[model samples]
Target: MSDSGPVLPWLVIRQDDNGNRYRVGRYATEDEAQKIADSLHARGRHEQLYVVERISQPAL
Candidate 1:
């Protein structure tokens, strides 16, 4: 037998580091994640940020 689950929405944030790419954070929604990114930008951590829509794999 096999187990499967539904897919859910996720917000992925990515940042650039001198041409190198890295993930900053992941959240349940874009709004929530953007808010965090805005805060980070205010603190001067990241100069460029983006929000991406994604779906995680099945839980089991």
Candidate 2:
């Protein structure tokens, strides 16, 4: 979550009407992630939904 890290913690998630979820991809910035999600949602089925979320990097 820190700006100093090179990790991409922003996630683009897709969820279906059935409540099933899948990870679309990851991005370095929230805006980037949201844009990807929006693009997917625009072209995908109407019953599906796209969202952006920030995730913490796992401790190594």
Candidate 3:
């Protein structure tokens, strides 16, 4: 199989109080993505959650 070009494995995901998840952004490194997640979390809005994840495939 051919490899996908310019893949970003790191992802920042946002989840709302209703359990709906969204992709906030993508990064080249986990640290970069986590930094964004941390900043969002620091907003102190308990109704939402931010998380970082490493994935194998490109987003659709």
Candidate 4:
């Protein structure tokens, strides 16, 4: 974050009943993420959706 390359990406996901996090997708804005979650919910996937800031750097 201190290096100032680009702001970290936001992750939109939900934890399943089995304690597994469903990696929905990354978005530039929370609203975009929520739209995806809402669409999924309309189809009957009931789980809490949230946005998480993640490091943009690739994992080594």
In model 4, which regions exceed 4 Å deviation?
1-8, 46-60
For all candidates in order, the CA lDDT equals 0.61, 0.90, 0.89, 0.64
Best by lDDT: 2
Better of 1 and 3 by lDDT: 3
| C-alpha TM-scores of all predictions | 0.51, 0.82, 0.79, 0.55
Global Cα lDDT for candidate 4: 0.64
Candidate 4's displacement at residue 47, Å, is 6.5
Q: Ten consecutive residues with minimal summed lDDT in candidate 1? A: 1-10
Quick one: how many clashes does candidate 1 have?
0
Off-target runs (Cα >4 Å) in candidate 3 are 1-5, 58-60
Evaluation by lDDT, superior candidate among 1 and 2: 2
Candidate 3 C-alpha lDDT tens digits along 1-60: 236566688999999999999999989889999999999999848998999999887456
Question: How do the candidates rank by TM-score, highest first?
Answer: 2, 3, 4, 1
Q: Which tens-of-lDDT digit does each residue in 1-60 have in candidate 1?
A: 234343236655556666555567667666777787677667765556554656565565
- lDDT per residue (tens digit) for residues 19-49 in model 2: 9999989899999999999899889999999
Steric clashes per prediction: 0, 0, 0, 0
- Give candidate 2's error at residue 35 in angstroms: 0.6
> After best superposition, candidate 3 residue 58: deviation in angstroms?
7.5
- RMSD, each candidate, Å? 5.3, 3.5, 4.1, 5.4
Using lDDT as the yardstick, the better of models 2 and 3 is 2
What's the residue-level lDDT of 1 in candidate 2? Answer: 45
